[model samples]
Target: MLTIIGLLSTTFGVSVASALMPLISVELFAVGLVLKAPHIPWWALAIVIATGQIGGKLLHYYAARGSIRLPRFMQRKKAAERKGRVREWLDAFRANCRKRPAWTGVVMLVSALASLPPFAAVAIIAGWAKVPVTTFLVTGFVGRFVRFGALAIAPGIVSTWV
Candidate 1:
């Protein structure tokens, strides 16, 4: 019971930290491996960690969405100009997403799994672009699950080879 609680807390804390900063996820996965080795199953650990990560990422997504909801009139001139450029880009992205949702989904999945383009950036952009919350959550969870799952299993695999 105590071990389960510790594991849950560790996964939750690490997930929140990683959502705020990308690199920490990898580091925490490594730490989890070292700390939980022999006692916990890799798949179980991965699932827990991934779930926590998704939770944290949800917070990030909502925060970005809220930020973008701020009144345009309040923005400074330079900020407004930058916002215009971003809006233009987002428009194009939305078009592509509409025309080829499968392609967009694949891209998002691959990027999330590989940690390419950074998950935080992707999450912020997705939120700002008003990507459907269901799509975001599903793709993000799948990607994170694969990523953290691989990380969780790597040490055991390496030990076998060595």
Candidate 2:
């Protein structure tokens, strides 16, 4: 099905660019617009895109967590430092978790909503923060569903309302 293909491709694309958050966000936004056209049912498109993006984020987060091994060229001592960096970042997040749970949730939610295309930055940060995986996935799904759903519907809504 076209929907399945779109979801699969979008997930692959977003996952591949998780490390390049700043760039992919914009591209995803544009792609969302294109996917919103009349030919595509807004619900299907939104669901597919939202699910795909979340799936991609999880993929990237786990990849960064070192589940996937790097190439020999990339496995030098300097590269190994990245694992420590991830630990440090996770520590920083844990330190703030108790003192600022509400703020953390709000900020993560906003960041997830506002983040462009891939929105991997929020996921990476969440992972670094060592936030519970459930929390991250829930916020991500809700934020993305709202954002992509709005993108899919706003054009029609405005055209009719205005």
Candidate 3:
């Protein structure tokens, strides 16, 4: 039981790191664990990793929402100080997101599952768009759980065919 707890803790830590740092690649780590630690259940790994990922992404979400203060260098320019077609387009898109929140949630969920627009970017965008926290949490979690679970179990599933 202690060993199981330790493994879970490790998965959580690595997953959080991977979420914060794109280069870390938690998917690779999970697949490696499946190959090396056959004793751990794939679904358990998926849940732990997904929790850690969501926790890490929450920081980005909050920061984008201006709930978490950032250093001057990291902060975006003030809206009044910024001007451009891109800015206007972004403002329009944000308004659209607010008007069609369900659509935004679906986009976020798809990004979480497929990394189409990139989950990291979507996390920040969802915050900047003022997406409801509950929606972000639910969609992101469900997508991530399914994605990581599939990866964690893929090796065993494939090997069984041979």
Superior candidate under TM-score, 2 versus 3: 3
How accurate locally, in lDDT, is each candidate?
0.71, 0.63, 0.92
Better of 1 and 2 by TM-score: 1
Distance from true location, Cα of 51 in model 1, Å: 1.3
Ranked candidates (TM-score, high to low) = 3, 1, 2
Q: Candidate 3 — which pairs collide?
A: none
Q: What is candidate 2's lDDT per residue for 1-162, written digit by digit as tens? A: 457567546544663454345445533553555555456666766666667667767765565555657677753355345576766775677689657867767766776677743356667666645667777778777887777767767767777887
Collision pairs in model 1:
none
Cα RMSD of predicted structure 3: 1.4
> How many times do residue backbones clash in model 2?
2
Candidate 3 C-alpha lDDT tens digits along 1-162: 348778789989999999999889999888888888878998899999999999999999999999999999999988898889988998999999999988998998898898898999999999999999999999999989999999988999888998
Best by TM-score: 3
TM-score of each candidate?
A: 0.79, 0.64, 0.96
Better of 2 and 3 by lDDT: 3
Q: Write the per-residue lDDT of candidate 1 for residues 78-135, one digit (tens) a residue.
A: 4355666766876788677778877767766876798787777778767656677888
In candidate 1, how many clashes are counted? 0
Worst 10 residues of 3 by lDDT: 1-10
Worst 10 residues of 2 by lDDT: 18-27
What global local distance difference test value does model 1 have?
Answer: 0.71
